[model samples]
Target: MKLRFGTGAILLLAGLMLSQPVLTQAQRQRPPEYREIMQAGRMEDPLAKIKAFEEIKQKYPNSVMMNSIDYLLVSAKIETKNSIDEVVKLQKDILAKSTGPGLITDYLTVNDQILRHKKADSFNKQKLVETIKKNAATGKKNANDAKILDSVPQQYRKRYLALSSTFDIQLATAYILAKNSVQAGRYLATFAKEGGTKDGEYFFRLGQVAELNGQKQKAFNNFFRAAGLEYKGADTKAKALYKKLHGNIKGFKEMLEKKLTELPFEPKHFTPKTKWQEKTALVELFTGSECPPCIGADLGFDGLMETFSNKYLIVLEYHLPIPRPDPMMNPATKRRADYYGAQSTPTTLFDGVNKLGGGGGKGNAESKYNEYAAEVERIIEKAPQVKLNVTAKLANDVVTATWSANKKLPNTEYHFVLVQKQEKYSGGNGLKLHKMVVRDFTTLDTPMKKTVLFNLSQSEKAAEKYLHDFEDQRGFKFDTIHNKIDRAHLKVVFFTQNKNTKEVLNAVICDVKK
Candidate 1:
């Protein structure tokens, strides 16, 4: 998709360029000249495209689309210029002006292009790798800045993460090409310790590192796993390595087939201690089924469930119609969103206050999972200050929840939620199954031991009314109706929180038995 800048953005760009003092008269006009930019992008011939883009760059020197223009111009030049030096110079110019994800992307592009140029001597390769590494460090620094990441639109976060992942793998390959085996192995070890990418290329690189370190058995195992993934020439390398290690390649193909059916490689991470925690951590995810960015957050939540037991963690997903209409949205879900003051999809709150916003696409799921896993571990280690428990039963379309707490502090509120264990819906975001969806909820100003009965039949009508009101208020259309309740698969959640501080004191989840 093409990124267009408005008058304000162009003016901001102009302000940032004022110190350059080399702006053309046309650039000083500060006009929105996106049409010319799009025209350049659509040019058929490479030379023509390069000329058009160069002209656009000269005319709209302060355009926010300067990055896009430079990238396109470089791409066109790659097709027309036979000199590797000129291509390298163009990429270097882009790298100089780029920051954040753009810098990382351009670095990856430059490094990959350099690698593909077989004519490049070792000295040139070393120089290029050094430049790329220096710029990659800068990109990482900029990306680590909270303000920079928050400035990015949530939907674009996925693309940024994917680019960063590719940059990381490419950086490792660059070190290996430079014959810095020590650095490559060190980098791969650190990445693995932090839960590295799940791609087969990672394992292939690990195999190379193992072979370099003289661990032939380990190298064979790594190559076998990489070959199982069928990544590029890993199968041939795995066969050759197996023949050298075991004196035969007879069982190599069989091993590869068996490994193919197994789960992908997962690096080991420190598991958090959960034996003595007094209260389980509560993680609430606010998401939209039609929102593309929520895919990573949704999958990350599923990973959290697999990684931690319910005795240590309890999770709830609240649906909202954000960026697009979602079928899973309802009144209670909207109310929960308001309670947390959540304004964006894929926003996750840990214990009510530690809010992590922005998620990416499916390719970014593993990164997001690692991020959440780290936070959950940190939060789980906190000493418990309150004790809460809850139980519930489902019978004749009625849910009875009994609750008790050690004590309730001032400005504290108790919340009871009915969660559907799982729901199936073919949503716009391509998610087929949604878990732990909030079907209904209620809040009380004070806490007390009592039995609350919820009639599913009445709640269903209320859900319909809520949907109708939401449609009228927002003037939005929903693609499908999803108010139906599945009583057979449901759970009840009880949580208490400080209304003023928004810290969840305690929480518990119980199955709704019929």
Candidate 2:
């Protein structure tokens, strides 16, 4: 022991000592490779982090990191697409284990998603119903099942209660789908009292359930209440449904009241006016064949025309230029449409007055037609405002018309229109059919205010200029308005009087179909 060692032996011992490795306490306590994935997620590259987490899961399947990796995957899926199918599966996977904090948030999120996309034939609905029933049974069995209660933390107890209320609402909806109004109504009442964020939907469900149960007044009340709520889509649906139903109910009551009120009233006796020429009625329909609803009104109008076919009842169909195929559309019609402030389809006029802005539907077409017919019958049987005498001639393509009123006219606008009738034309199924179309119109301008005499000399020149500009700008050729006698088929309509006053003293429908 006291003797000195050889140099070679000393060098070999030193080399062996240096070869052995040693680590500090701090280095030994460092986090594992899985932490890098979480760090990447905190740095905002969630997809990349997800991929890295998946790799960690593959490498260490049984490690504690697997649970967190699964949660992150579920969260990523939900955040990306607002989907909960994979999240629901993940929930089922961890249902046995006591999931840590934030588990309630996930559970509620998945439950809401299931309710949102539920369909009658979907497995999600069936699974949800089963789970709800199981939970209800278990809740009744053990009032203090820590396993169920602890699914959510104490800090999130209120959220769990809100979610429970939502579950009840969904259960009510399921009952509604099953046509069980009693259970649905009972649950709806409970949901309303619970006061959840989806109160609008709850009240709307209540209204629907009440309607199914034949409680109309209750349904209306619930619908009105739901409409007053702040839910976006649901509130709109409730309001629209309520308004429609209310309108129907009111209309029925008014009809009964009107019949009762009219029972005691006697019909007025018909008396003719002193001047027969002054009594004339004009019916202008601002319509288009392209409008489906307008077609129904047109059919009703056709029936009226066939029934009345008198010079006193002059019907003019002005085809408007809408974004659709309208072979009947003419410049005169568009001018008339613009004059009446008709921004909507199927506008109608009775005696130069706008009768309806947006005309009635097919269901109400017959009633509206009868209304107009009755008014015309009253006017023809009574006195007229003014008398109109007119003469029209076509030299080349230009039409010249001179009109004189028997009485002093009101300070109102008047228009002159040229119409054409089709005797034989190509139509549906490649067959020849007939049509009536307006060709041109002269704007309302008079040299003398409220005078009986008027001339188309100046108006004709302006109309020609306008037509020329229109054709040049729009690249569409139109039939000449200067002379029209050579066409062999044409009619002139002298529409005299004001639009706002509903005064149409005289109108004539001539058949020039060749």
| Candidate achieving the largest TM-score | 1
Error of 1 at 481 (Å): 4.0
- Ten residues in sequence with the least summed lDDT for candidate 2: 1-10
Candidate 2 is scored at a TM of: 0.39
Q: What is the RMSD, in Å, between candidate 1 and the native fold over all Cα?
A: 8.6
The digit string of per-residue lDDT tens for model 2 on 1-514 reads: 0001121122222222222234356533533755664564453454665676677777767653444456555444433343334435554643343233223233333344344432333434455555544443333232234554454436434333444455456567667655678887777677556754333466667787987887766776665554443223434454455466666344543433343222111223324444444466777776655564464355456556655654666667766534343444545566677777775566677776537443322323344465566777766765666556656665544455656656556665566666655423232212122234555666557624332221234444544566566567778665433312125666666666665565665665543332
Residue 303, candidate 1: alpha-carbon lDDT? 80
Candidate 1 wrongly placed segments (more than 4 Å):
1-89, 99-168, 171-196, 200-277, 290-293, 357-374, 377-383, 426-430, 446-449, 461-479
Q: lDDT tens digits, residues 1-514, model 1?
A: 0011122122223223332335567765635877787677667787998899888888888775565566667766765655556667666665676544443344555655555444444435567577657656765565456665554556455444444444455566667666677888777776555444555577778788778778888888877766664556778888888899889888877888777544342423446665557667899999988887787788888888878878778899998988777777888988888887898898999999998876755535666778888888887787766787888987788999998887657788888998998889978776778899998898865465487778899888888888888789889776677888898888999888887999998788899998
lDDT of each: 0.71, 0.50
Q: Which pairs of residues clash in candidate 2, taking residues 3 or more apart in a chain or in different chains?
A: 396-483, 397-482, 397-483, 397-484, 398-481, 398-482, 398-483
The TM-score obtained by model 1 is: 0.63
TM per candidate:
0.63, 0.39
